[model samples]
Target: MVQYNEWMKDVNDDAKLSSLSVPGTHNSAACHVALPSVQCQGASVTDQLNHGVRFLDIRCAKLFLASGDDANDLQVIHGKFPVKIPFPLKLAKVLDEVYAFLQSHGSETVIVSLKQEGQDTWDNDSDEFPKVIWENYVRPHQDQWYLGSGIPRLGDTRGKAVLFRRFGVKDEQLSQNLGIDAHWWTYNTTDDDRGEIRVQDFCELNDTNDVQKKSDYVKQLTSQAIQYNATNPADPKLFLNFCSGSNFFNPECWPEKIAQCMSDANIQDCFGKGCGIVVLDYSEKDDYKLVKELVDKNF
Candidate 1:
């Protein structure tokens, strides 16, 4: 049996972060009570981390208030709605949780994929999004982060959080130090090869009938990652295969519904395979079978 909290301890330090199989949660911090369309995850960040989830998909929005108090603060959100109801969840709090987890589990490294979402209310042209992240969140805790542009070895990021930046930076110097450069890619794609990373983020489902297509795409990507690693052991590109989708208006095709369909799809074939970082929705279902399967691959 594998220990979820410290599974990385058994992995070789020389292994590249891109070459190993990793479990991840999509919209990771959206565990609070919210509308079905907004809430994508069930387990909290700490719970996910404790259950072998190493990658996190965090979407942040700039909260520019009328009074300008805490204007620089970033709120965790999903689409247009705040992830946590009654009280807003801040990026600072999420980082605190990650830092605490890393402090106790020194052998583990968390990959945080931060995307700037919900910019309809504010001007998107303003480069304040990346600036705020760099100045307020990252720079203050520089020592705890792996701010490199290339894929890192497991040893280099054991006790730190690796940044998978999804937003662009205006300043050239700041951009260089903003960790892995995954700023842009083809949206709603099944597969888009970008040299360093190959992504399969086909999120929008036209109807419930499209669920099977989504599942097939996920399985195909998983097999591709495994094959890529076998042939290119020396230098493997990260495969971010997302097993999540939704049909916005159709209640039958919401995130949970899609997750259930994905769960039923024979994912056992992916076990013990190099599936890169498999990002999922509602990862706590079926006693965390998905997380366990992905983590067991590393051992």
Candidate 2:
């Protein structure tokens, strides 16, 4: 059996990050969530990393512990649901695992799309909000990250996590001062601009959409993102396509089911040679074949 690891080592250092077919997981830390509707991934961060997942969609928040002793530095969450490790661990622990994995596999670079979830907000009114995050997560682990704003090559970030912030700490200057402005993007599609990395997060809101419809939607978004990267060429535009969706009203929108539908629909063939960052759900099953399918497109 082949022990697949450090696949990105095959890619040249001059190859643009935008040109790589990055396999990512949406709500990557939500595997511990008990609810079927909210859980997005079936693999732990380390497992996903071993499975050739290069991008991680991490949602975090500073929260009070269950014992009410003190707030954890950061907790990986999925909307209102709290995902925990065996006994429970902070977001920092998960990141440590990612860091260790990269350290062991020197040729692999990981993209961490870090976003704030829950009631926490990076507002100017409360300076402590962003301050706590910096002092705890960013400051302590600064050395393990690539904070550059530009799209870096694989060699530039190997054995490191490239930070893609999704929260606004303050005004333009203030956010920059807080170090939150380095390669950040608007929260949603409505606020998206063509100049920065564009994202498509289309999901079935009412579950009225059938499996075929949702599959087609994923294909359309995937194709457009690949085309965008092709035409932009020189521009460092990245297209993040979210292949995860859910509907509280219908179990059909569950992530596992959606992933199955995608696999059955043969959508992987539509990804072509450059699909940018393709984030998926339920990627742990089938030896993470879905993620491998996307990564294979880079060749």
lDDT of each: 0.88, 0.72
Flag clash pairs in model 1. none
Where is model 1 poorest over a 10-residue stretch in terms of lDDT?
63-72
How much RMSD separates candidate 2 from the native structure?
3.2
lDDT of 2 by residue, 222-258 (tens): 7876887778767766767777777766887788888
**Winning candidate number (lDDT):** 1
Task: Please provide, for model 1 over 1-299, each residue's C-alpha lDDT reduced to its tens digit, 9 standing for 90 to 100.
Answer: 79999999999899998889999999999999877798988889999999999999999986635234375688899987889877788989999999999999999999999998875354445666777788899999999999999999999999999999998776788788999988778999999998989999999998978898999999989989999988898876999999989877998888898899998887657655577999999999998988998988887
How many clashes (backbone N, Cα, C below 3 Å) per candidate?
Answer: 0, 0
Q: Find the candidate with the highest TM-score and give its number.
A: 1
